[model samples]
Target: MKNFIHDDFLLETDHAKELYHDYAKNQPIIDYHSHLSPKELAGNRVFENMTQLWIDGDHYKWRAMRALGIPEKYITGEAPDSEKFNKWAETVPYALRNPLYHWTHLELNRYFGIGDLLTPKTAGKIYEECNAKLGLEDYSARGLIHRMNVEVVCTTDNPLDSLDHHRDLAESGWPVKVLPTFRPDGLITIEGAAFIDYLSSLSKITNIKIIDFETLGQAIKKRVEYFHKNGCRLSDHGLPHAYAMDFTEAEINNILSERLQGGTISKKEVAQYKSAVLGLLGGLYTEKNWTMQLHLGPIRNTNEVILSKVGFNAGVDSIGDFQQAEQLAGLLNGLNNKGHLPKTVLYNSNPNDNELFATMAGNFNGDGIKGKVQFGAAWWFLDQMDGITNQLNALSNMGLLSCSVGMLTDSRSFLSFPRHEYYRRILCNLLGKDIKAGLLPNDMEWIGKIVRDITYNNAKDFFQFPSYVEKAPLENG
Candidate 1:
């Protein structure tokens, strides 16, 4: 019997197979957005076992194991690494039709040369086989990145972070451009538990006491320059919804003063304050030519009972039914009117907002930048096959899909790079089926270039990494 994953895996037609093999298969990856660890890459850390490499810090697996009624000890508690791997293998058979099933096999085949489907029956041998090779020099953190032909990896970073690891990697000359993305969600979120302390660290780092709104912008401006000097060209935000409520600068200042004084703030006041801060940051981003990524619509920690055990970011978040279009259009329009709108990518966690986001992106594209406001890759819960297809279809129907910046892992795992391949296959299949249906022309040369461009070129130019990108040596190939 043939392996479940093969050259023709998701490709459904001859044209699809040719397009993937000829154009998209081997393009170098530009992971412009991800949650990967800069410290691991800097140190070239080696995995001691399969669980550490796959299960630890992966809430996807944790959620799956919990669904299988596996105890918390096996999922995230004090279970041994070997036992964790065993629990994950047992849950694999139950994960059918889930993205995790495909991702598990893809990572296994790409990284460890294991092709058998993961299940309880095959768990022990596969685990031992993977653990044996993970300690090899070629399986180190940097090695995994290079092995996947990654050209640039931009990691999400907090504003208060020193980015010393990025500096170390750049000077270490490791070839993969390990860069940082400015993520100031904490800075904008005034109601967060750690808001005051986070600002204190920001003030200390920039040496500008953030006593109020003006000083806060100044300190943030200094950090933007700091990041730009360190080769950062991207910024990211994670919010429940767009904050575009109208408010005067004085109101914002008063709100900041209220928060600083341990006074209460109303929900409307919070919205106004965040809107004011977002507008302020937009100008800062445009000044530095940064791409601001807004990842909206996640009602986090919905499972308070699960939260008690997982602390946070343990995969308990779900899609929020927040009002998106009006607030989002307001935010983008406010930025555009002020001439402070930088290149921006809009990501919506709720699938219902796909077309809304696609059409909204077109409203700001006349500023001489191609695909200025992007409908970013399907995100979080929506990164699977159906989500990817629907997102692409919406962009193709309402916006220019050809100039797309294309797929990103948006993942924290090193082995998740094959998701790019997963996306490419689905993309090619879409075009191929269209061609076979006579909906598109039989011009492989033209369509193939589109495939190649979407897979790699657009991202390289979109982020403009020419300034800091360092290519890995051919010997590493």
Candidate 2:
């Protein structure tokens, strides 16, 4: 039979084919947000087999396997790597309408050149072929990134991290710009069980005494300066909702003291502490011209049993139905009023808030920045095709789609770069359909420029990462 993932797999019409092949296909990826390990990139680690390369650290596949009634031993337990691959192969055919089905075949075709369907019958042969490729130098971590034509990758990092790996990668002179993004979720989450421990770690990292909120802010500022000097120009936070409650510095100090002293604080105090810390960080981000990304509305660790076994990020998170609009507006407005609202990207996991987020972004889109406040790409559980289309449509209808920054991997696996290709095809197909239906004018040249901008230029301009300036220019399509 024919190849399953041909050049025109997702490109349905001639217009779609032209857009994908001519405009979107060859654009260099600027993966500004991902969970990839900086150590792996720095070390250039090679994998032993398909399971180690593909299935490990991929919670998407784990969730699917669990849904298929597969046991934990086969999924994440001490089963042999080959057996895990067999279980994943068996689960693939059942994921027909899921994004995993498309992602699986696309990754297979792109990486391993395997065109046959992944089922029980073809599992053994495909496994061997991929394992053999994994043993090659070109399939190493750094090599895989280079082969995908990635110009830049910004890995998420905690404030307490030493960033030795990032320094190593930068000094080694890898062609791909591997940088760090400041993620201060641990510092801001005062109510979490690990709050005190995180504070102690931060104290150790910064060598600052954590007696009050002032000292805490100083510690965070010190780390931000360190990160900035080390080529970081972005910060990210994952919160259930924006915290904008008003509180004085003294009140915040009191709250921090209570929490540090093992005193139980109320929810109101938690909000006050969070608001104080986030607001302070927002000012720092603005001062340094950093792009701040807010990922809101994820209800994490819902299943205690599964969470106990697997800890966090093992696919037990779901969308939250929290009250977002008022607090989000308050937070942004407070920063804007102070002229400290840096370029921000807002992402919501709840699909019902698509229009809410799009319009909210529009409310703060001035100051000569094209898309200063952006509706971030469909995130978390909403990264599927339907969810992506909904987010795109909402942004197009409510905001300026041309100025919107494009897709990112947001994944922990190196093989997830194909997700960017998947997103680009879907994008081109949408615009092509619009042109054919006369919803948008038939102007390929103008449309193509827009396509290229969203695919690469927007992010490159939006995030003025220090490494981008230090490195050579990216190749043109």
Candidate 3:
């Protein structure tokens, strides 16, 4: 028996399904912030098999395996790919209510037309079939993007990246827009073990002698400018908590000097330095009109023993309970009162802070910029059905859902593109249920357009992709 309802498959009569088919089906994806390698994308690399396609770079699977009681030897270990797939197969049956189960089957169905539910019994068959198709031309990276309707993808990149692949894509003049996002996490964390070494690297990257705080600021500015010239319009940061400390210029400089001279700086000093740098970075974002994203409240790498063995993003990070609202308020209000706040999106990992996240978004959105301060959609661990629905409800209740930019993958696997569709299906279903209950009128045209905009067009416009008009050379008579 094929698991159709178990599939929760969208129906034709369902308003949400109609909306998805009518509006979002043919549109292109504009992934604003992802960790996908631009090099592989430009080269149009192919995957070896389903396991390699889905699990090779995905930390989500690693996390799920850990949750399923799989040993690390099989999770991130050197076990054969077949053994890993078998282990994952055993876990799939137990993952009944999990979004991964749905995502796994959906990818199989959409990509390979395989309708069989994935379980230990059916795993070998599905694996063999999918791996056979892996050799097809349509299975290549760019082909996968084309099949998924992805038009513009901006990969998160460090300050040290030369963006050679980005240049290649631009020169190729493909319809797909592959841009780079300036991620300065390496530069921003001034208390890490490699802080001074990273500073020297930044100096070399920008060819500026970063001897003082001002010099470091200048060096960062230079790199940002370079990134902008190469078609970057977004900046990303990962912070444990939003920095809101007050600091004097002398105070910040003294801390930087201490770190430079091999002196051990205390935790308080780290906070002040981070706060001061974040303020300056916020000011730059304001001046440049760039969209800035903060991934806040991640108690990163909670399993320190595993961290020491396997390193970051190996399924060890967890959400933290931090003073997010007040801290975010201070940082945002500082820029808001000055009329210099840029377009901002806040992503919180802690589900308990959903209201705090939603309300904080409202506080900084006073400039009549529709959807300016957005509470990011279910991110990381929250990218599931319950998570997405809850986030939508929160946004709809506290702010304007119609103005929201629907979903962003924030993912690593090409197979994870189905997540966008999953989000859209859930969104439409919510609206459909409302209409069916007479809460809203079932106007297909308007609702369809809204659906389209949310799933595809909103992200397109939000990220500022080059359009037909923009592509034409400017008149210079």
Candidate 4:
């Protein structure tokens, strides 16, 4: 029988095959955004088993298992690694059209070279095979990344993080660039129960005792400069929506002071404070020429019961219906007006806002840059096949698709790099389908180059990362 995944798996036409194989496949990956642990990369840590590497901390698979009524013990509880892998394998066959099905199998095939379909019957055999290979030298943490042809991995970090792991990786001079992305959601969010606690942590890290909003800015600016000195070039924010309301320094400072002193602030006060913080951080990013990423529109941690048990980002989050256009445009325009809008990437989890985001991206393009403002890659629940396709279609219709800094894993798994491969196949298929329908011309070479540019070149120029040449494995001096 033929394999389920093959050379031309998602490519439905000859033109698609040509674009993927000839132009896109071999291009190096610039995973500019991910939640991968910098410590793992720094230590080149090796997993004890397949479950540790594959199933553990994988909320994607956990959600699928839960959908099938699998108990939490088998998912995230203290079930044996074998049992967890077994439950995941069982969940796979039932996951049919879900993106998890494709991602599960793709990671299996890519990492272990196992072509066998995952099922309850084959789970044990496949699990053992994968664990055996995990014992290999090439299956080590950095080795896994090395095999994936990733050039840069920018991990999300808070302003107060030491970034010791990123610093360690950079100093080690591994061929793959492991960099930090300044993600200050904790800082931006002032309404959370832990906001004051987070402020204390930031103060401890920066030693700039925060008495008010202006002092908070000074502390965060110190951290941003610290990150810039340590080679950070990007900042990422996860907000329900943009907080670009009108506010003065005094108003924000007063609200922050009250909050800092354990006094509750009103909702409007929170918005004004968040807006001020975003604007302050935007100016810092602008000074360092760093890219700023806004991941908006997710009503996170809605399941209070599950949230209480599992903490946040445990897959209970869902797409939100927040108004994107006015708030987004307001924030971007405010920054642009102040010449503080660094290159920005906008992402909304709600599919309803695709064109809204795409057109908003077009509204801020200038400074001779190719894509100064980007309708960023599909994110969170939207990082699947259909979500990716819809995003590309929206961008193609509303903006210059060629200038798009295409596809990011936005994932926590090293194996998730294949999502980039999946994206390239989808991109090629879309263009090829267009050509087949006589919408685009029959020019292969030009179209092929566009594929390559989206796959790597656009990100290369867009990020302005330090030069990298993948070399041999690390050896003792």
Candidate 5:
């Protein structure tokens, strides 16, 4: 029987095969945004089994297993590791047409050199083989990253974090650049239950008492400077919608004081506070010449029951339909008016906003930088093939796809780097189809340069990290 994951699995045309194999396949990955634990990379930990490496903290697979009627015990509970692997194997056959189907086979093939289909029949043998391989040095966390040709990884971090692990990794002379991204969502989430606790921690970390909005801004600025000195060149925010409410500093101060006094505030007040803080943060990012990424349109923790049981990022978030265009325009315009709009990337989870985001990015894109404002790669919930193609088409139609910096894992697993390969094959196939249909000129050399740039070079030029090629040679298959 033919294996499902062959060398040209997603590359359907000869043009795609040539482009992917020649230009995109071996390009080093610059995962500028991810949620991988820096501690694990610093420690160079090795997993004990396939379950630990493949299944742990992977909510994508968990969501699929739950849909297949697998119990939570086997998915996230106290089931034996082998039992969990068996259950995942059982679920794989049912995941046909899902991205998981391709991702599973891709990971198996790329990481373990296993091309056989994962089934109840092959699960035990495959599990044993992968587990045996995990014992080797090349399968450790750093080793796996090295094997994937990863050049730079920017991890999401909070305002109060120490970044000690990042320091440790750098001082240890690790070749890959592991940097931190400033994520101050907690500060903007003024209505969250833990808002007060978060403020307390920030105060402790910065040694600045948070009395009002001014003090809060000053403390956050201090942390931003600290992060910048430590090699942070990016900031990330996740919001259901952009906030651009009109308010004064006095009003913001009163609102913060009221909220800090354990008072209940209205939604309008929440918007005012968030807008003030986010606008100020934008100026800070501009001052330091850092990129700011806005990930919008996710309504997280929709199920209260699940929220009470498992908490956030546990696979319960969904696309939000909030009116994004007006307020998003307001936010960017407000920053641009001050001449403080930093290089920005806008990512939307809802497919409805694909064209809107692409066009919105065009509104603010000049200032000498090629892609100063970008419609980021199809984001969470939109990272699948159809979603990716839709985003690509929208950007090509509405903006300059040539200058766009492309894909990131946005993942928590070390094994997820194959997603870059998956994205490249899909990208090449799209261009290949265009050439074949006479929609685009038959120019493989130019197209191949675009492919290589999107795969690696665009990110290198867009970001502030030292060049990877200057430091070390990229690994090739």
Candidate 6:
């Protein structure tokens, strides 16, 4: 067997090895987007056990297990920790070439210095060792942040949240920065019966009398402003595709008025409402200088029976056949022509649309704005080794890879910090191999700087940092 998977592997050039080494060793983590709990970060809490930390909030593993036909007993069921570990161990070898394989190995190595493969043979030892260390004082949430060298993290948050957790973290003067991104998906989706209930929730949060369409608009506006005041500088939207319907404000008001009267909307009316309102939402984001993110091409809620049994996000969403480029172009062109567009990041899942997404991402930038309009990395199902490498190549060929802000885990797992390392390794290998073949120049200093910037510095500078700085070094150090 090979001594090491990444042993002196040079992708760009032989000389590039030194550069990759320097960058990988020193770069801090800047997780600009994720779904980690701000409450846990604020409290700096410790984990009860490795199972709770690894599997409790990870729907990815749950989805993979479902794919392997492992019953829910080993999944979200009431199985013992050892049994769950055994099941996960059984699934590890089958996850070959999956991002989970790399991530699992990287976490084991990074957190526990255990380089051995995890099969049923090694599962018990790995579990016991990790559990023993997790009982120590230095394994708290904040301590883990320090251990991983995470500089900042931005969490997806609802428009209705008071952001008390964020405020508390800010006031605590912790080393790591935890902030929020404004996610208003529930407020914007008007097709469901829950739209009226969402409206009620918004009404309570904004303290506005949302009696009609005009008041509804005002209530959303107020909440966006509230989120802005709470250190939110980005807005996020998840959609099947970009909206293309263009209609007057009065037309939208008419639809809202009908809905207020308890009238059911036609399919056409639903499209019209969603399209117009998404445009309005974009305009609001533009005016506020918020970096707007639109994630497209997901066909959510696929497993009807499982969806009914377990609800959404049990990992049933698949890619949709959406022509995102033309629609995105139309929407962004409208905004850009009006001079009302902010910095925009577009993310999609369909690999076939790579060229389309790359070209369209570059189209919205009229002036020489560095990141005014950009393409986000492979997200969700595409956030794997092959997926991220494909995205990097596409961006490099079509757009500017250096200017492109790189990988974000978008995960709920605390052990997912290794994902950043995984991305860095893949990136270095790609660059190193290219340089080795004399495709790119072997400039170690410049290459190292670019690696570090993409891995850490770019995201740190892009987002706003918290007010507090680091505490003084301990006397012993």
> Per-residue lDDT of 1-477 in model 4, one digit per residue for the tens?
887888898998888888889999999999999999998889888999988998888888888899999999898889998898898888899999899888878888888898889999999999889888887878988989889899898999877777778767877878898878999989977888999999998888778899987788889888887777667899999988998999987898899889988999889998898888899989998998999999999998888987888887788988998888888889999999999999999988999999999999999999998999999988888888899999999999999999999989888787788999889989999998888889999899999999999999999999887564223223200
lDDT of 2 by residue, 383-469 (tens): 989988999999999998999899999999888999999999999999999989989888899999999999999999989877443
Per-residue lDDT over 1-477 for candidate 5, one digit per residue giving the tens place of the 0 to 100 score: 778888888887898899999999999999999999998988999999999999988989988998999998898889999999999999999999899999999999988999999999999999999999998999999988888999899999987887777777877888889998999999999998899989988888778999998899889998888777667889999999899999999999999998888898999999999999989999999998999999999898887865676667777778898899999999999999999899999999999999999999999988899899999999988899998999999999999998888999999998999999989999999999888888888899999999998888988898877432121111110
Better-scoring candidate (TM-score), 5 or 6:
5
What is the full ranking by lDDT, best candidate first? Answer: 2, 5, 1, 4, 3, 6
Q: Tell me how far the alpha carbon of residue 448 in candidate 5 is from the true structure, in angstroms, after superposition.
A: 0.9
What is the lDDT of every predicted structure here?
Answer: 0.89, 0.90, 0.79, 0.88, 0.90, 0.78
User: Candidate 5, after superposition: displacement of residue 59 in Å?
Assistant: 0.7
Candidate 2 TM-score to native = 0.97
Q: Candidate 3 residues 1-477, lDDT tens each?
A: 856533346533477577666766666667787888898888878888777887776777777888889987777789888888888888877887888888888888778888887788998998899899888888887777778877778899987788778777777767778888888888778878888899888887778888789998998887777777677888999998888788899989999998888788888888888877877888887777788899998888878888887887877777787878877888888777667678888998888888789988987776656788888888887889888888988888888777777787888887777777788778878887777778878898988788787777666666664442122111110
- Model 5's C-alpha root-mean-square deviation from the true structure amounts to 4.2
RMSD to the true structure for each prediction, in A, is 3.7, 3.8, 3.7, 3.6, 4.2, 4.8
Q: What TM-score does structure 6 among the candidates reach?
A: 0.93
How far residue 462's Cα lies from its native spot in candidate 1, in Å, is 1.0
Question: TM-score, each model?
Answer: 0.97, 0.97, 0.93, 0.97, 0.97, 0.93
State in Å the error of residue 137, model 6: 3.1
Stretches of candidate 3 off by over 4 Å are: 2-13, 366-368, 466-477
